[model samples]
Target: MNEVAQAAAAPGLAVKRNWLAFGTGVGIEIGAADLRVSVVRLRPSGARLLGEKTIEGFRHRPAAQWGAEYNAFLRTLGAAHLAATVLLPRRELTVRTLPMAGVAEKDLASAIGFQLDSLHPYAEEDAVPAWARLKG
Candidate 1:
């Protein structure tokens, strides 16, 4: 079985998992000086890197231009169907972790939502909050 879910937590991104034992994922990292894109195929056996691209000085270039270039790169590798996980530099983001040891998976969002305001400086109206539950 393959389940595809549109994550309300992150707009314009889709999460998919296959019980058939294989899937694909794309990651785009925005570094200090460049935009890097990579695609990988995940199977029960292992993860295989499909393709990658590094666009230098992406900040100086128009987003539409570079975005198209990146899109083309994915299309060339037949990975245009995958939703990319965009990674921003750590310093550029405010990262926080909470001890949700007893929080059930279903209530995770509400647990985070209850503490959202205290976690960041942005006002509720202006802030866009995203979180992930990591297994340590």
Candidate 2:
């Protein structure tokens, strides 16, 4: 598959991905109590940020709206498609160590989810979980 499709599928496949380009699309960032929207243009080295404005007059905006707006923005940038990456706040993600044996790919998420369910009683779905194996 191409880069954009690969990036989008990576998350669902339990792999990590990043948005390398805006591709004629905009990005919207939504927080629990805050909302942000921006359009961006990509360069070979970095990105040119545009539409750095806050959308007002909305009491409760769904996260999906932000995503759609971002995609539309990318289209305006002359990009045939766009890459979407959901950036979770650092505070929302709890990174910690865990002991893991020879684990299979299918079981890894469940294993971590099980462990985190205890530590994160509030909302495990709201957070992202990752792990690593330390050298002996």
Candidate 3:
């Protein structure tokens, strides 16, 4: 990841063109009581697991402290460019699939977006809804 940084600072995964050659990324999961991280590199030959880390009682620890440890691990593995993708606990996420048989491609965004509030429990201000159009 960028700085042995906590995934909270860089919550989403961003791909770089150069990554097509390296295929390196870090996966971070925020669990109920701890945080887990994994760094992997994919090559034509196969995928290699470079490193893994877990921090217990993550909710109670200071961000800076655990974040430093996070950075240190990636620094040791020389994973400076890997984007950290953080996965929140299942309880924090809401999944809803809408059947839009007639929604035009251009209207897909607005169609799903308008229903975001009803899809999630969070208040209007707190909700950060994201969607994708799935194909069968």
Candidate 4:
């Protein structure tokens, strides 16, 4: 059996991959009470299934806690893939689609910054954010 299957078979197992070599990517989303995160294996046609983990009790302030939790998730899951994209709440964006306008072209970081500012309810300027365009 491969490492992936072994890890998957074990309860509460985390899978790590060298994203640069494997072309894998990570996705994260901020939820109301908990943070939703996932790992995606990138492919020419689409992203393949790898693994996902969620961090509970995510608060707005004291951002360091989130980092620590993420590190813990990676360590517990044994995931070494460093490239990650965090998903922001769509409602945070001050965008209305009355006429079905297209999505914004700005970098994902900027958009997340805006979302964090509004969703956080507290001022935060130290977190770094990055995102990639995912094909459907």
Return the lDDT, model 2, position 88: 57
Q: Alpha-carbon error at 14 in model 4, in Å?
A: 31
> What TM-score would every model get versus the actual structure?
0.56, 0.48, 0.60, 0.45
Which candidate's lDDT is highest?
Answer: 1
Question: Number of clashes in every candidate structure?
Answer: 0, 9, 1, 2
Residue pairs whose backbone atoms clash in candidate 3: 4-71
On the 0 to 100 scale, the lDDT of residue 129 in model 4 is 39
CA deviation > 4 Å runs, candidate 2: 1-32, 42-47, 55-59, 101-110, 124-136
lDDT of each: 0.83, 0.59, 0.82, 0.62
Query: Between candidates 2 and 3, which one is better according to lDDT?
Result: 3
Please report the TM-score between candidate 1 and the true structure.
0.56
Cα lDDT of model 1 by residue, 1-136, tens digit? 2343434445534233333458889998999989899899988667899988998888999999988898899999998888899997876677887999888999999999999889878766877888888978
Which pairs clash in the backbone of model 1? none
Q: Candidate 3 lDDT, tens digit per residue, 28-105?
A: 999889889999988656689999999788789999998888888999999866779999878888888899999999
Q: State candidate 3's TM-score.
A: 0.60
Q: Candidate 2 vs candidate 3: which has greater TM-score?
A: 3
lDDT of candidate 4 over 62-130, digit per residue (tens) = 679878878777665456657678777875543421221255755544655555544444336643334
- Kindly indicate the candidate among 1 and 2 with the higher TM-score: 1
**By summed lDDT, which 10 consecutive residues of candidate 3 come out lowest?**
11-20
